[model samples]
Target: MSNADTILVTGGLGYIGSHVVLELMEEGHSVVVFDNGSNASRDVIDSVSRLAAGKGRVDLFEGDITEPAQMDKVFQEYSAISTVIHCAGLKSVAESEREPDLYRAVNVTGTSHLLSAMERAGVKHFIFSSSATVYGNSAILPMLETAPLSPQSQYGKNKVEIEKNLHAWQKKNGGIVVVLRYFNPIGAHKSGLLGDRPKKEAANLLPAILETVSGKRPELTIYGGYNTPDGTGIRDYIHVVDLARGHLQALKYEPDNDGVYIFNLGLGKGYSTQQVVDAFIQETGLTIKQRRGQRREGDVDACYADNTRALQQLNWKPEYQLNDMLSHAWLSHKSSLM
Candidate 1:
């Protein structure tokens, strides 16, 4: 298979998906972005196009992956989309608990719907946007891809279910499937053009912290009481751009490589929530008022990654440091407001 397949990115305007679109364009891959326009906008199309600068072709379609007819239309129009990066899903843990049915419908059933569309379209290569949340409240430190399949939250359960379903689908149909169990994806494209935002508001950590810096909120709240030394949860946060590049790597994965390839996308080191806040303050010389609170349910004390598999298998390594993540994320936050 050629590396230049016209790749279709579901939720293409989303934070991680947009960054991957830019990377694909930079690498001269023909790209098509399919979005529901729920969590993102047409503005991202312009940003990605500008980044591409005629290096490649980019086409956009306002659609949702959950709808088979909509995805079928996308497939019909873009028959050249031989590969897909599935990123469309409901992602909030709290929201998932409130509406497990929705999460299941979107993340699991919706994904199954997408896989069916792919099979019909004869698109054999797939990359799924999974989360480390699948590990969920584990006793393990620095999780490996081989970690247990016990997820605690509804959101995480959704990811785990879809991963299992994908494994089953791969076994039956046979294709190149890559499951990327991503840790916390912070930062943004180094160009400051993309950042995370849901259809409604921000719930992720770095975005919440940045919002506080913008004075959109009064203060940052650190959920404390975890078993970690800082009394807050620790996570391995990878730069969004680095995580995005991993998708491109998966796309370039050898066609002969059959079966499911799983990799944990992270920095292989953990940082507490407090540490992230302090890093932000240090990076920008900004004072952030933060208070500790009780640990939320389904919380883990520390969860990093054992990313040796990704490095050795994908021939890719995370390049940005904590400082780079802090600064670049802040810049992207500012850019989003502008």
Candidate 2:
């Protein structure tokens, strides 16, 4: 928790990790980033280094998580590491369906490898970047942490498996482990230095909206036009900065009688696909063409979060609303293109 605490952030060059790294540096913590850069670029690291302004140093480890030797090298170099924020995993539902083998190899096997390395290195604190997909197609409107998990995609199943593995690991090791089951994380850092950098084509809505606004893509497709008030699928979209701050707070939490904790990070409000498109148009004053398409293969009707537990436990809550999310995302999008 000190300024000198060497924290290992896997996938630190990615969208979510870069924001979290900035937050960690702001809190005066030293970070070592371990990313394969398969889905990221060296430019992101350069951007982060510039954002840090020499206040924090980021040591990059470019290697796949499935490789044990690569992970071992990180532990060997940074033996003083006390906490790890594991964010290094493939996270596309459509892609996972196309390549289940890759998902199992990276999400499942890669997580196991990281756990083993952390255990061997004596790192106690662990924070897992889990997903809302674990509670797939929930009958509950705003899904709670205790909601029954029925993951619809391989990516969701991977997250469920990882959370279970973390539980088992905690039971044997007696260390503090926090699993943050996040909703749709949108937006970029307010500084415009970090944002979502998808390697392949983006499946998420915000990035697609940005593409439409930037004239890279034409006509945003509104999948499924028979769901809710707007006749489109609704989702809980949390700002990336707020989500990153939640991770920092999770790291600060002490074990509550039990050593493990799980909390959902979201805005506790739902936004339909049409609503998002409308918001983007309103924010950017750009005419975004739209096409009504069929529902995505693994799409769900609606899912937000009962963020009360996160507020109670981690003393964390999102400050940005939908408008703020849209504005910040637009800022990052414009900045990146420039």
Candidate 3:
């Protein structure tokens, strides 16, 4: 695709999607951000604008993917759009367990609506925001793209269902479809202008740690008694910025044949919860109150990634290390307090 191509980013105001939008704009592509004003701040665009610095054009649209008419209207309005980076979805695993049907409607049925709209608009390129949760709590140490999918949570199930639909959709309609199975995305933009919204209750690890250090939470619970070296669950944490760049690489990738292309976005290593907490304290010299809690049911001992395919195929590699991720995240979280 040329730099002139208009790229539509669903959930573009979101944490990860906002970073992807910044990356695309910095690369000089016109961006049309479609979001429903759910779980996002409109002021995020101001930060994106400051970072983009007139590299490309950006337009924001308020619409829900679950609404077919809204999806169709965006496609029809932006008739010149050639590709889509879908990042909108309800992502809380605990919440999904409570509302499985809600997850299905937004993550599954909503994606179907978007696909139909794309079909009508004649758009052929798509980049989906998938998660490593699709692999479930496998005993496998490092997960690969071809691993058997056994999603345990409703969120993971939603991603697996979407992947299956994308495969079938590609076979029948013929399109360049890329599925990115993200392991664990953490961190924020270097400028501290963009990051996860400061919430008293955070679902992810990094945010929880940041919140505790910033005194938002009383103490960070370190779920323990896992079958790992540190007795804590280990995960593959990739910087959000790195994950955003991976999408840009996906946009440039050309498939060898007519099938869905899937890749894992991760740091290709594991870090225990205790290790992450220690890293945060060491990197930022901040105190994080902590407590020990029993491991959550269905929790895996270790989960990382086998990023060889992403490295060899997309020519993509992560630049930040664990320290960089922690430092940048702290900077962003600290800036939010000001």
What TM-scores do the predictions have? 0.96, 0.96, 0.96
**Separate clash counts for every candidate:** 0, 0, 0
For every candidate, C-alpha RMSD to the true structure in Å: 1.9, 1.8, 1.8
Assess each prediction's global lDDT (C-alpha) against the native. 0.87, 0.88, 0.89
Q: Model 1 over residues 1-338: C-alpha lDDT tens digits?
A: 12346898988888888999999988888888988888887789899889889887688888877789998988888878888899878788878888889889888989998999998998878899999999986777779899897787899899998999999989878888999999999998778887785556677899889878889889888999988887889999999999998888887778465899999999999999999998989999999988887887666778899999999889888999999998999888888888
Pairs of colliding residues, candidate 1: none
Kindly list the per-residue Cα lDDT of model 3 for residues 282-306, writing each as its tens digit.
9988878899999875466788999
Task: Give the local distance difference test score of model 3.
Answer: 0.89
After TM-score superposition, the amount by which residue 71's alpha carbon in candidate 3 deviates from its true location, in angstroms, is: 0.6
| Candidate number that wins on lDDT, 1 or 3 | 3
lDDT of 3 at 336: 82
Give the C-alpha miss distance for residue 250 in model 2, angstroms: 0.4
lDDT of 2 at 227: 63
lDDT by residue (tens digit), candidate 2, 1-338: 23358888999989999888888877777888999988888787788778878776677778878999899888888777789999999988888999999999999999999999888887878999999999998887789999999998999999999999999999988889999999999999887768987887887899888777677787788897556887898899999999999999998898556577989999999988888889878888888888999877777889899999999989997899989888999888878877
CA displacement after TM-score superposition, residue 53 of candidate 1 (Å): 1.5
